[model samples]
Target: MAQKSFTASVNAFRDKTKAQMRDVFSEAVQDVIETAQQPKARGGRMPVDTGNLRNSLASGLNGSFGAPSAGGYIVTLSQLEIGDIAQFAWTAPYARRMELGFFGTDSLGRTYEQPGNHFVGAAAAQWPQFVAKWAARVK
Candidate 1:
């Protein structure tokens, strides 16, 4: 009687796939950032200037497949400044209100309308397509 044993290694395949996926994800994130940075039309009734808001926009990616336990890659888009002032002036607080027109007027007495800056919302809307493109790259 003869006994035969075979060993198959998948480490190389896994590593290569992981690297490719990372690259694809990085590129997709950059695209999202660029889209978010584009100047959005003034949707507010107050006609506020958007130059500063566009300039303050930024994006970043955190975590990786290198450490799955730490959670997968996360792409974040945000304003550069920190604290309540920044948050109210440019970040989510006032931005969301402006975009959604939740309030009639801001502290500065600027009137709002439905659908504001749409910065984050626009980027999020493109997320599905971005993921699909990244997946296609990996495939």
Candidate 2:
């Protein structure tokens, strides 16, 4: 029947769209990871002490915040759904202090004026551009 044929077509289209969206989102997250790793003098925005913070960056779907990767890692995009949320996070305990800065000593008794890095903020600023770039890739 025509209705059955149309239904099949619609499902195919939906599947394609979802696949494209997942690709876009995955690329965007990768871009953020690369951007965050750039050096301050060069292009890196994240603070680097032991490199743990840099390695802790991760992107997960549906609020899954797993342990930080030894290196950069991204969730498999095939599991992404049409309405799933993509979240990027740093699992480091001091990630907040690095981003927001700490002007005083901590419980560890070692601290000074640590200015906010605004690293993630920098990547987030590119969100509009990411959307635009990826939107064009969608069919």
Candidate 3:
């Protein structure tokens, strides 16, 4: 085959594989959100408040933050590539406080002595399994 033809074929294959990986990653992120949102009986610790925090959970390519979704995070990671980083984020203002614990006064000058649930961390602990499960589904 011509060099140009060979290169084009290889490039197409690479793109397809990358897309598949992105799909796998996206699914894995969705799994994390679902796990974190589960009820306490199911081993999840996040309490359902106004539900904003849960709805705001989103996944993006190398993004540490995202605008809170009006509905809920759709778990779309289309732009991720082989070398790109995938990030899971909660856009709510109190997300970090809830996850990591807050025992002192906040910037808003409110007092809080809440213990940490680390719900997201608990959910993310299974990241390797999630990724493996998603990857196995890729064709």
TM-score of each model, in listed order: 0.53, 0.76, 0.67
Candidate ranking under lDDT, highest first, comes to 3, 2, 1
Best by lDDT: 3
lDDT, model 1, position 51: 49
Off by over 4 Å in 1: 1-9, 41-50, 58-94, 108-111
Q: Residues 1-139, candidate 1, lDDT per residue (tens digit)?
A: 1222222235666667766756665666655655655544533232246444433333223321122211112323221222212111133335555445554676789775555656556675897799788888675
Q: Write the number of the candidate with greater lDDT, choosing between 1 and 2.
A: 2
What's the lDDT for all of these models?
0.47, 0.73, 0.76
Which candidate leads in TM-score? 2
Model 3: lDDT equals 0.76
For candidate 2, what is the TM-score?
0.76
Candidate 3 to truth, TM: 0.67
RMSD over all Cα atoms, model 2? 2.7
By lDDT, the better pick of 2 and 3 is: 3
Task: Report the lDDT tens digits of candidate 2 across residue range 1-139.
Answer: 9999999999999888778877887777666666766657675777776778877776667877556673435453446666887666787888888777889988889878988887878877887788788778766
